[model samples]
Target: MVTEASETNRDAGSVGDVAARIERLPISKWHIKVRIVLGMATFFDAFDALSLAYVLPVLIPLWTFTPAEIGLLISSGFAGQLVGALFFGWLAERFGRRPAVIACILVFSIMSLACAFAWNYSSLFVMRIVQGVGLGGEVPIAMTLINEICATKGRGRFVVLFELVFPIGLVAAALFGWWIVPTMGWQAMFVIGALPGLVCLVLHRFIPESPRWLANKGRRAQAVAALDAIEREVAGAGQTLPEISPMKVGADRHASFKDMFGPIYLRRTLVVWLLWFGTYLCNYSLTAWMPSIYRSIFHLPLEVSLRYSLITSIFGVIGGLACALTVDVFGRRKLFSFALLWSAVALLSLWWTGATSAETVLIGVTVSYLGITVLSNGLYLYTPELYPTRVRALAVSSATGWLRLASIIGPTAVGYIVAAGELKNVFLVFALVAALAGLVVMLFGTETKSRLLEDVSP
Candidate 1:
């Protein structure tokens, strides 16, 4: 009992030492470089994810696909993503984050090139799932890295700024698709999407592995060394270093997978899973289905279909930016509740219109997306905050598995619903989902604003 008590105290001290070291560091040029390097990975993931939505406008007419085939085509990539999220979550925990990140980048980058050469429906289908293994793994791992690095004071804004790269990538896809698909053909986007892989070559040069991760794993020497390097970089950038004082942490700081599924974490797991499922179900359905909806349902020209979709993308990005700026001020729970309820209202408005014309659907979808887009990106910031370092990546990645499931179900449901000529009913279903998510969050979600990660989860 004496030896065990002493060991527990030592473990508690180690966790505090690492958290204090990181929390003292200020925002510097080195941090920006780290964000830039990781930001490119997600920028292209978004670009690649959105690329399929744009490509489908051409493929629907060229390949002559039915509703089921189109839905499966959209869903196939998500199936691979679900695999990537689970596998890499385990990989990041078992191995290290840097290795898992580099491997996923290479996999997706190479597979993206394979997608470019796809000869037919079956060929592209296989390539996308394989490519998705990379795309799905990148963002969650990236989020875990950024969250681990940031000081507690600026974490929300800092992480969300990095996440904003994702929506910007979506906008870039829309912007580039307007010009490129009309001129260079559908193959060009895949070629462009693969370019973020080049970032993998220089990743190790810019950022070090997380000190918190090393500390939690009981590699105290390595964790201190990593923190020392960051301090030197901050000092080199002409910023004064604050004195390190160890924080007080809960004994639960050292965690395992079984502990994660234990009663302590079960409620957190369920709440975030609901947030993940509701947010993405509305988000991907609106984005992936819109171009095809404009082209097929209304018989719009291809350029016009993309242009209308672009308008909504711009509005959605506005919502994303607004959410990032205000999260710290408004608090995570309130902001999440507001965005979910707001979207529920916008989507329900479409249901009230009774199967409207194309322009009306466009307006309602854009309004609905404006709110849902906030949750879509902000979850990257919120999910990581709710877990300790040992299982942070695993937990975030697992929560995002619901996102993969939602993406698959959302678009496929839209496909079947549209095919059945129950177009407005899609908005009704999305509204109910959004509203339910809001109520759960408002009632059960913990407020994590301005707390150290160790304090929030521990």
Candidate 2:
């Protein structure tokens, strides 16, 4: 077995030897292939995560869903995601990234299928919660694995480019709702989400476990085998791989959850929590309710509401792409902080405008989406960079778990805030949150541009 062979080489290899090998390899077809496969899986993950937003507009009329019930349905998945993120993060650490990811994919896909078969709101809600577990787990593990494999020089671009697929998934969901819900039904969306199950086979067959992760686990041979597989592909393509760097060996320290608050990581951990909480709080608060807001408040037709929401999501994808293009160049701290502040200003503008006209609302949403999407996508790049490989996935997942808490509170608050008929309050509240997030980043965030993961975190 690979594990047995790795045990034999454990004493022969120094710490970070495998990471150095991985970091030194130039980008090649093998890297592109892995990104494509992972990107496809993420596309569906995004699709399933936001599919409920579109589905709810249709379900509201059919099931007579009240605002409170709507909040529960929207938050149920995030509640599951909180559990899944922590559980799967631990599984990634304990078992392996490859197995944990595949398990999460299967769990969500099967539960998504069950969602299609749901006979009532309660049934669908339960399925969404289960599906949320898979949705929550896959992302942090995927980011951690990508971070492990990527070169530092362009790490932000690589990770953010992969994350771009998520907003694309949102756009796809909006389009699906625009076209499908009025004709076929809401259940069809879940059926499409279930198709990602097929991606599980491709992932299992092709995606290698993170060499950094293997090396961290003291499975040196397995780590080398993984790196060698990529090196062989690079070499076969007639490109000479770079020589591995001489890595400084450090004590093999196992990270615990308690270490998250230790001096080295405490401020970083707090900044990330604020970032995740604020970003998702603003994002889901606006997005999860947009379709319904358009239909209920603005008195637009269902098709028009979905289409307007689609336009806002298109802006989000554009913003995410802009961030991916510039994050490495602008640096993580400056770009993230600036984007958050920009979003806060946009939300404040919306609040001042009274959010009275569709034109005013659309413009506000477009600008806010642009900034928030950048922060939303950028957080994935930023979070894992804060921790060493020993606790990378766990820290990222745990930090992101704050997003689930915000998700629950944000949408539920929207229910009450919108219920009060003072929609402007939502903008004011989110604006303050975004402003505070920007301040936190400016005050405490570390710049990770062009630095090796080990150097930045360790």
Candidate 3:
């Protein structure tokens, strides 16, 4: 295995020796390929995560599910997600990031398709839980890989690039749902959701095992080979090569289950968990219940309401990309705080406009979606960076599990609000949550700007 020790030996040769050998590996091509793989996996993450919302606009009426039952179905995925995150984090530690990620995507994809075939409410609910597990695992693990691979100088760019697709995927799903739900029905929308994952599965084969994992595992030969591959790809177009330093490979890996609770990481764990929980609470509330909210308030046709929802979703994608572009330079802490403040304002505005005309409400909804997306997409970029490579998957998963727990709370709260005709109160409460999330992040979260992945850990 390639350990830090092995790197010293590789560096012992004339500095030129490391440079020549490392230059032989293909870095640019592989980087692009890996980024594509991560993005594609996120596509499934995007689809499965939000697909429930699209269905809610249809399923509630078709099946005559009560508000409480509909809330249950929406949140069931998050419960499964919590389990998947912790388990996959452990599994990634036991096996490897590549295997865990691929397995999670495949499982979720199949289960999402299974949702299409669900014969009753119970069956659908069960499949959603199973599907949630897979959804939970894929993103954090993929993020672990991406964070490990990119240079510290370029890490923010890469992480942002990694997150940009999530909004796009949701927007796509919304557009498709709007088009198909009326004609082909909700079932076909889910079947279509399954297709992207299959494509991702086929593409996933090309993604290599994470070099960081290999180095940590003491697989020196494979680790060196992987690094060499990345170097060569980067050296394309006749760029001058830099010396590569090899790390030692033969020690026992430092990552352990207990490391998650280590003194160095414990505080980080709490902050990230809170951030995930609070942000997700606001996000899922607007998402799972928004279409219905629009329908009730605006009295629009089903298809038209869905179309409005889809347009707002596209703005979210825009917000995500904008945040990604500036996060590193502007700083994660600043962006997160700024986004949260806006999210709070937007949510409150949404509540205030509840009684207004359809046009005014539509504008409020768009602003609300924009704020929430900026808050979420901006902050999630920080989750994997909080821990070292060894425990990164675990840390990220732990945080994500909290997010699922929030999902359980957020939608259930929406049900209560709706039942009591207190949807406006729900928005105000979520706005406060959004503001608190921002405060926690601004005060507690460390700025990862201009630091190597390993450097940021301690």
What tens digits encode model 1's per-residue C-alpha lDDT throughout 1-458? 11222133454326787787678788889889999999998889898888888988988878889987898899888889999998998898877788889888888888888888988999999999999888888899999999999998978888888998998899889888877998999999889989988988899777688878888888777876677677777888789776566577865355577655777678888899999999999998889888888889888899999998888989888988888899999999999998999999989999998746778888888888878988988899999988888899999899999999999999899889989998889999999999999999999998889999988887
Candidate 3, after superposition: displacement of residue 193 in Å?
1.5
RMSD of 3: 3.9
The predicted structure with the larger TM-score, 1 or 2, is 2
Clash number for each model: 0, 0, 27
TM-score of 2: 0.96
Clashing pairs in 1: none
Candidate that scores best on lDDT? 2
In angstroms, give how far residue 261 of model 3 lies from its true place. Answer: 3.3
Tens-place lDDT digits, model 3, residues 124-199: 9999999989999988888877776666565676677777788888887888878878888889877876765665
lDDT of 2 by residue, 76-99 (tens): 999999999999999998888889
Identify the runs in model 3 with alpha carbons over 4 angstroms from their true place. Answer: 1-27, 200-204, 236-239, 245-253, 352-358
lDDT of each: 0.86, 0.87, 0.75
Give TM per candidate: 0.96, 0.96, 0.90
